[model samples]
Target: MSELINNRQERIEVMKNLIRQLHEGRDEEKVRRQLESVLQEADYSDVFLMEIQLMEEGISRESITKLCDVHTKVLKKHLDLTETPDAVPGHPLHTFLQENQALLQRTAHIRKKIAELEKVSEEESADVLMKIRFLLNELMDVDKHYRRKENLLFPFFEKNNLHGPSTVMWTKHDETRSYLKSVIQALNEAENISQKEMIAFARLAIEPAIESVEEMIYKEEKILFPTAMDLLTEQDWYDIYLQSPEIGFCLYYPEFEWVPEGGLVENVEKIKASDDKIHLPTGSFTLEQLINIFKTLPVDLTFVDAEDTVRYFSPGKDRIFDRSRTILGRKVQYCHPPKSVNIVNQIIKDFKEGKQDVARFWINFGGRFIYISYYAIRNDQGTYLGTLEVTQDLTDLRALEGERRLLQYDEE
Candidate 1:
């Protein structure tokens, strides 16, 4: 007992010294090696707090990136101790990573080609602009990666009371998104860019976006992931694994199967079956059926198609705005208040003209505030049907929180 106590005390001292060094920005490489060695031998719970302390002390991004690979190796080794097989190819997470890998590669290729084209004379710049436009369209896939984390992973982390790191990471994600959008806008408007201008844009816009993604991976592997591994059960991970494919990944490829720990393989099939249905009070329905049901909802929905026409609308419950049957055949402008008619017409015209797709307005009425938004509805073919007008009451829906696991019946 005395020997074990002494050993524990020694490990504590080592952790404190390493953290001090990292905080002081002294010998980061040596300190990182020592930290990794400590992690390999210690219980995760013992080192977890110290690791967070180091992170709080401003560890270098380069150090974080290097440690990410180390953490992956450690996780793989630990996971391999279990008898479960690896996750299959085209598994949700796997597919996400695969898709994002292609996007990242394409973005890099486009950047390189644009750089080469910059060296040519002014007459050849048009070809470069065309290439940049193509790349911008491809780079829009960044939204997929952001949505996956925000929609899927963040919820799980929030449930575990790990909000601090999650919030920081989310803020970083937004910053990266803003940078990408700025670059895309600049690239679109740029008629002639010299080599220096292109290089500056690449540094300011493209590289930062990539670095942000890479840094996120670092945080995930070292902090968010380990916390998740500790807090979430195998079932939780399986659920995430199942849903991940929908949102996809960013520059990732998985080499292992993700068979849920201690669960039967058939469980994956069951999850897939249930995932295909939308559960409602009355009954479950297929995806297409659910979409149609939402369209037929009690409130009226008017969609400005990609072509900036009134293409589709749904009737759903408790609609805040009035949608008359006569408005169905008319231009979206005629449906609005005359005072705001010009703005509506302008929004529609711009959407059809590919200038803008979203317009929003809100107002207080009948002792309650209402929020209304118009989203340009476009299909995969880039065909604009019209704008979707969604208007909802802000009173009751804004108060939702916690889990609603039980059923409540309401009689008409």
Candidate 2:
């Protein structure tokens, strides 16, 4: 092989061949050495192109995902030499790196605790186990981190027809999530197990979970971030930055506000179109009138699209819960706390599957009895369109003693 491998197509083929060798169980170190000259000069885009081309050639995404770690192992040296894209404070990439730093610190702490478990006596093992559970609980926050990537960042890749790698990365995210869940469950059920058994479980379940997270950080900084920086426009990043708050941050949050040199722009055409009347089968209303009608309704209303993105929320004067514009493009799962996300997912799942159409619940919050109902929005042809959430403060309604036939106005 020549020392100077300059042709773009040749570089791609060499990279692809190396990855194929990895898939075929070639010795990683040997293959790496063979590809050293080519990889030494390969940048992040070249690596991305290699994966995309492999996918185009009918390589299964599952196969690529399975080989992803092996690919990383072979490419780690050159990837380390690859320059990371610089991002200012509050930029999405900067925030992701910061979260990775926090996650690394947490994983280090967990490893130290695991080591301490070995040293501590049986009398002290309980305390060590407790600390590990607490850390694992915090580690679960990584779901928000991954959700931000899948929901906020990956869409831009899809728009660019660069969907394969994102799918592969998402598969890895699910794998990490499974490991975290299994470890957490094993820890939760460790009460009756022997100390030796507990230690074995820790080794079996915990270590892999932490390593999955760390490996993802490596992939992001080395390949994904740099390639995305090369491919995505400034506007794409700006949109991601704005919508990130809906999902929130992981262990870290950005304190510094990042404003791009180019300011945020509103869609002027949309604003102009708002003045025109919207025609419906039965009636017509200007956008202003439509908005006012929603605001005047007694219940707070939010509409999430079929894809689970929050698309609209009514600005009622007395909403049972707060609503913000930041949530407009956010995923519905992130709108709820971690504990309730499972229920939210279940509701959407049932709605989409047509197992159910409406879910209702009532809770006493802040001394107010609030009634919440979720209706699956569907089209005339019975196709699921999205979900409509209607929330009302039912404290006064629950106290009603009698009803009057005639309408009566309450005191001002």
- Top lDDT hit: 2
List, residue by residue over 1-412, the lDDT tens digit for candidate 2.
3544447778889889888988888888888897777876677777777788899998999999998898888888888888777898888899998888888998999999889888989878877877887787677777878999999999998888898899999999999989987887666554566677768877888888999999998999999999888888888887788788777777786887666666544543454576779899999999889989999999999999998977788998778899866456556765664446679999999999999999999999999999999999999899999999999998988899876889888895
Model 1 error, position 55 (Å): 8.0
Candidates' C-alpha lDDT? 0.59, 0.84
Predicted candidate 1 versus true structure: per-residue lDDT over 113-144, tens digit per residue:
65766577666765665666556545555555
Regions of candidate 1 where Cα sits further than 4 Å from its true position: 1-48, 51-86, 118-121, 218-231, 241-412
Candidate number with greatest TM-score: 2
Backbone clash pairs for candidate 2 read none
Off by over 4 Å in 2: 1-6, 265-412
Candidate 2 structure lDDT: 0.84
TM-score of each model, paired residue for residue = 0.50, 0.66
